[model samples]
Target: MNPAVTPHQQIRATHDAETVRVYQAFSDEIADAALARGTFVSPPFKMERMTWIKPSFLWMMYRAGWGLKDEGQRRILAIDITREGFDWALTNSCPSHPGEAMGKEDWAKVKDASPVRIQWDPERDLFLQPMGYRTIQIGLGKDAVRRYVSQWIRRISEVTPLAHEIHNLVRQGRLLEAKEKLPVERPLS
Candidate 1:
């Protein structure tokens, strides 16, 4: 069952009329190389493989251990892309588990047919505790993976500094200021 999600833990999509922002974590080998080359060049990334993106800063930190640990999670990227493209994926996405969005038949099709799956994990706080809300983690596979790398991404910038900044804030018990500096996100339509 999904955890209870509340507003305090949600990181809404920032898209207004045109674009939305998404975050991805990569290993230094991938992130460092991409930053130096000005694009994704290392490992070729097997566009056919599944890639995940998160919109919540704390959730990502929980997933990445705040960049202190986790192989290939040392670098984080904030990417700006067309809202249309993101909406397309959300519309096509299947819930990772059987829930309101899917019944038996829908889940069957999702297993092999859908390119994306959405999982809502419990929201995390600065210290990585489960918060009252939840965050979105979307998995991109199949054709969706290809489209994401070749078409969807517009701008990619490193946000490792911000990740560390927040981490430090939390460590120093400056939760309020850290929360204020976080990215403003809205729920997807």
Candidate 2:
């Protein structure tokens, strides 16, 4: 197991040498279509809109409410995509917020041009409480989205069942069991 990181922002995910896992929550129609085709399609999954992908499972649970959030976010999907594609997005990304180093106009121009947006939000624990550190959330758009759909995606699996199971365990105060049920997430090397 990798040592716990102390950095405020990091990319901790379930990953192998070739691929990394990301999570997305979708409605039944979108999830069904994507699952059936092995990739997202147009009718339900709009390509024009920016899509955010999260690597932290607990953060995802918080956002999706363990698959009970709403119809629009009822299905949780674990998507494994090529490390190359993931790296590409990071290399070409602009920060979602303007940094002190850059002026607003400059940041806006860069953000408008970049195909990916990177934001670091507070991480979550087993009970979905915010942690001290932050998790990376990648927002894909335009070319990045095209590449993600066509060249990046390796596999997609529904994990709403696992989400519910972990949630139940947490609710029952079985913190250890719930923590064990979480996917092994390590900082991406």
Candidate 3:
């Protein structure tokens, strides 16, 4: 929403996932019915590999070009998953990049620890400009992905219209209005 040119740190919006929320981009072939039905399966969606979920809305939009670009990123879905499952992933997560202060020895251990990876990216405003705070993108691989598809997700919902609406608002210079309509997000659970 251009954030009224507000200070970036003050506007670091993040989703509050009490029940574990995730954002995924998919091709229309795989996403259409799955989004409508809130489920996933093979064929349309490859169920054999790892999957990543971005917890940030704008970030997902940025990665998928608001579903306007990319061969298999024409649709976007917001998924609600079990908190238990989400926590399991967190427990198994390893920092994609180790802390700067880590000892070389500790770094080596963390490097080999878990399949799930946690990363943070500069948060973005409605206009997709970088903000002061960071947002999360977690990668799930190997057994983690299998569990995610089979047990974690509680429901999935299509947020294409909302995404487009926000995108247009930003493109048209109506930042405040776009911010008003944005889904409330903050870190929780």
lDDT, residue 21, candidate 3? 67
> Each model's C-alpha lDDT?
0.76, 0.93, 0.76
Model 2 agreement with the true structure over 66-184: per-residue lDDT tens digits: 99989999999999999999999999999999999999999999999999999998898888888888999999988899999999999999999999999999999999999898999
Q: State every prediction's TM-score relative to the real structure.
A: 0.84, 0.96, 0.82
The digit string of per-residue lDDT tens for model 1 on 61-167 reads 88888777777788888877777778778878877778776788878877677888888887776689986667788888778876776677777889889989988
lDDT of 3 by residue, 2-63 (tens): 44553333322333444666788998888976766667867677766668888778888888
**TM-score head-to-head 1 vs 3, winner:** 1
Query: What overall lDDT, based on C-alpha atoms, would model 3 receive against the true structure?
Result: 0.76
* Every candidate's CA RMSD: 3.6, 1.6, 3.8
Ranking by TM-score: 2, 1, 3
* Clashing residue pairs, backbone N/CA/C < 3 A, model 3: 1-126, 1-175, 14-185, 14-186, 15-185, 15-186, 16-186
The parts of candidate 3 lying over 4 Å away from their true place are: 1-18, 98-112
Model 3 scores worst on lDDT over the 10 consecutive residues at: 6-15
* Off by more than 4 A, model 2: 1-5
